[model samples]
Target: MLNMFNTALTALNANSTAIDVTGHNLANLNTSGYKAGTVSFEELVTQDLSVDSSDINGNGIGAPVLSRQFTNGTVQVTGGLLDAAISGNGFFTVQGSDGNTYYTRAGNFKLDDSGNLVTATGENVQGWMATNGVASPGGVPTNISIPPGSANAPVPSTFFGMNMNLNALGTVDGTNGTFTAPVEVVDSLGTKHTLTATFTKTDTNAWKYDISIDGGDVDGGTAGTPSSLATGTLTFDTNGKLTAPAADAGSVEISLPAFANGAGEQTVNWQLYDSAGASQVTQYGEASAVNSNSGDGSTAAQLTQVVMGDGGKVMAKYSNGTQKLVAVVALASIQNPDSLVAVGNNNYSTTPASGPVSYGEAGTGTRGGITANALESSNVDMARELTNIIIYQRSYQANARVITAGDEISQEILSLKR
Candidate 1:
């Protein structure tokens, strides 16, 4: 009778624990990156009732074993600038406030006050930050920090290119003899200066070229006068193709002397041909026209926003419509991810059972690729959990009936003695 009671009690306890596991799963159905808990019943030790008869009887139900399901959940688009999600097997490396390293599947990250990438609970995200728009992710990763309001310094003009045709049929004495092309160039101090190129027809299929700037832009000169900086001659063939400036010859050089604005000396290269040896300056019979001209220079620009791009890249966008790859988020892959120990806040700590971690950039080795502007939802199934709840409830009720029957039988036996 005592054994019967013990068996029923064990069944009740196991059923109660299974019900608790189901409840926990249902409660966290909406939690981001939450893994569902699963329960499995185990049988206690059994003994042979009679050795000769070979009859084996089961003892009782033992406690249910609880395990976590590590299957990936559905990825949903969130449209957050910094939000990210893993598409396969991998975890984001992070450093918790406790000074311990952790991993997570959640990618809903934000920049803290100090511009450090961190989770909602303030855990620092680990990655390789770029220096001067270059990043090396092969090295050891540290906390990724991108200061807000950062700016990109201005770059002075070094190369100026133009694709235009000087008239081959124009005369040398009329107003058609001179053609001027004005382009804006930047000095070392990021000051804009207008440099003009004048072409004068000297003879048939021959022309004199002069590169000049404003006299006031120099150290000492008149404000309104145009100062010549360089002079050269352009000789074309009968086919209107440039011949004096040979194809093998390099770009025309323009040197700027000391400026009144205290800017240093600068040298700008005037390209007559493109990289593919295509002629940019031609003496065609068409009308003289400056079709296109450009200079490589920019003013200082402010940081506009930081965006999370695909493959775990962090891009810093500037107000000048330029983007720089500022950092790369690192990912970790474990052989046995199911063995990881959950430390709350959607993070998991490494354990001996988890095996060694393979850390690298996403889409490398066994690590998964990342999706920008998205989040991973919980893996809990509502219908499955609800059904589990009913199953455990029925089992618990059956165990209670056994206990009630045992109690009634004991009472009858006591009454027999009375």
Candidate 2:
């Protein structure tokens, strides 16, 4: 009778644990990246009723073992620029404050005050940061930083080009043939200056050009006066194509002295022809007008936004209409993900049974690709959990009834003896 009571008690404990596991699954049904756990019951030791007989007595059920389902959950598009999700098999590697490494599938990430990409609980996301818009992910990873309010360094003007037609029927050696085009350029200090190109029809099929800047822009220069920086002659053939300056030497060099604002002297290249040997400056009977002009220079710009890009790239946009790669998120793959122990916060730590972790960029090797602007929903199945709950409840009741029946039989035997 005592042995029967022990067996029923053990079964009751096992069923109770199974019920707890089901409840846990139901509780985290909405948790991001939460893997549902299933309860597995193992049979306890059985006793042989008789050495030569085939009859056997079942002892009871042992403790229930909870195993997590490592299958991927459905991806939910959150449309958040910083959010990310894994489409296949992989985990986002992160470093907790305790200086220990962990992995997670929750990618509802945000930038901390220090500009480090971090999880909701403030763990630093590990990856390779970019330098000068290039990301070079190596064997080791570091905290990915995309600093807010950052400034892109200004680039000084190196070259300028224009395509236009200089009137062929204009008066020679006078203002009537002169056409002035103003082009803006940036100095080393990011200061804007207008470089004026003046062309004069000095003779048939020939023209004189002068490229100048405001006198006040250079040291010891008089204010409001044009300081000539370059002078050259252009000769065109009968077909209206430039024939004097060789195609290889179609660019004039403009040398600027030290600026009043303490900017160093720099040389600018003025291109009259493109790389394909096509003349940018043409002598035609039409009115002289600059059709287009371009300069390779820009002022410092502020950071506009940081967003998740394809292939797990972190992209930063600037106010100057430029985008740069900030970093690439790292993904880790384990041979047996089920061997990983859940450390809470939707993170997992590796154990010996999990084998070694292989870290790499997403979509490489056994790693999975990343889905930007999304998050992974919990993998719990509500209907399945509810069904398990009902089954466990029934099992618990049945075990309790066995204990009650054993109590009644003991009372009956004692009463008969009395």
Candidate 3:
């Protein structure tokens, strides 16, 4: 009779634990990146009924063990540039305020006042920084930040290439056949200057060219007046293809005077030949029109926006139409993620059973790729949890009935004394 009572009491305790676990799961159904907790009950050790008998019925129920379900949660789009989600297996490593490292699947990240990427609870996100628009792999991860009010310095114009048609039927003198092409170049100080190239037909199959800058003089030229920086002659074959001024001679080197604001002298290379060995300045039988012009330079620009890529790279877009890599978010993959210890705030700490952590860029090895502007939803299934609650409640009721019956039997036995 005592064994019966002990069995009922143990069963009730196990059932109670199951109810608590189910309640916990249901309560956190809406929690971001929350993995549901599951409970399992085992049979307690059995005892021998007698020395001569083989019967060994259990006397009590064993304790219930609680574990987390590591299954992936649904990913939801949040449309925030800094929001991120893992599409496969891995966790975003963050450093907590307590100076310990924790891993998480929740990607609701924000930029702190100091420009460091941090979780809602103020844990710093770790990543590699990019230098000069390029990121070097295999570096230790650190806090990723974007300096406020950052700006990209200007790049000076080094070369300019043009593709245009010079009228094939134009006059052979400066009287009726001259075309002026204006090209904009940037100096070391980010100042724009209009450099003009004048082409004059000298004779059949021949043309003379001169380059000048507006409001300035070429180096070694008369000051305060428009002066030619370079002069050369172009000759075309009977087939109307440029034949003279060989490829080596097709480029001109010119120097410009210092800017009023103390910028240093600028040197630019003017390319006349295209990659196809054809002169960009072709004397084809067509109207004198510029086809395309390209120059290598940029004015000063400010950082306007930052975006996260699928590969976990953060890129900064500038106002001058340039994009550069700012940092690469690192991910950690554990051999047994299910064994991680949950610390609060949707984070987990490494445990002895979790195995060694392997760190790498997302989408590489066992690490998962990143989905920007999104977050991972909780993995808890409300319907399943509700059903589990019903099952545990019924089991608890059955165990309670056993305790009630045991008490009534004990009372009946005690009544014999009356």
Best by lDDT: 2
Please give the TM-score that candidate 3 achieves against the real structure. Answer: 0.84
For candidate 3, the 10 contiguous residues with the lowest summed lDDT are 214-223
Predicted candidate 3 versus true structure: per-residue lDDT over 24-143, tens digit per residue: 888888787888989888988676756546667786779998788988899999898888889889998899988888999888888887878898889999988999878765656787
- Which ranges of candidate 2 are over 4 A from the true structure? 1-3, 47-50, 53-56, 146-150, 160-181, 197-210, 230-256, 269-295, 301-305, 316-323
**CA displacement after TM-score superposition, residue 319 of candidate 2 (Å):** 5.2
Indicate the TM-score of model 1.
0.84
| TM-score of predicted structure 2 | 0.81
Choose 1 or 2, whichever is better by TM-score. Answer: 1
Q: Across residues 1-418, which tens digit of lDDT does each residue of candidate 2 receive?
A: 8989999999999988888888889999988889998888988877575664665677888888878898889999999999999989999999999999999999989999889999989999998888888877668788888777999888899999999999987888665588999998888988888889899888999999999988998999998999999998999999899986778786888898888998889999988889888999898888999999977987778999899986789998889887778899999888999888889888899998999888889999988889999999999999988988999899999999999999999999999977
Runs off by more than 4 Å, candidate 1: 48-54, 163-182, 199-209, 230-250, 273-295
Question: What lDDT score belongs to each candidate, Candidate 1 first?
Answer: 0.88, 0.88, 0.84
lDDT of 1 at 390: 95
Error of 1 at 134 (Å): 0.5
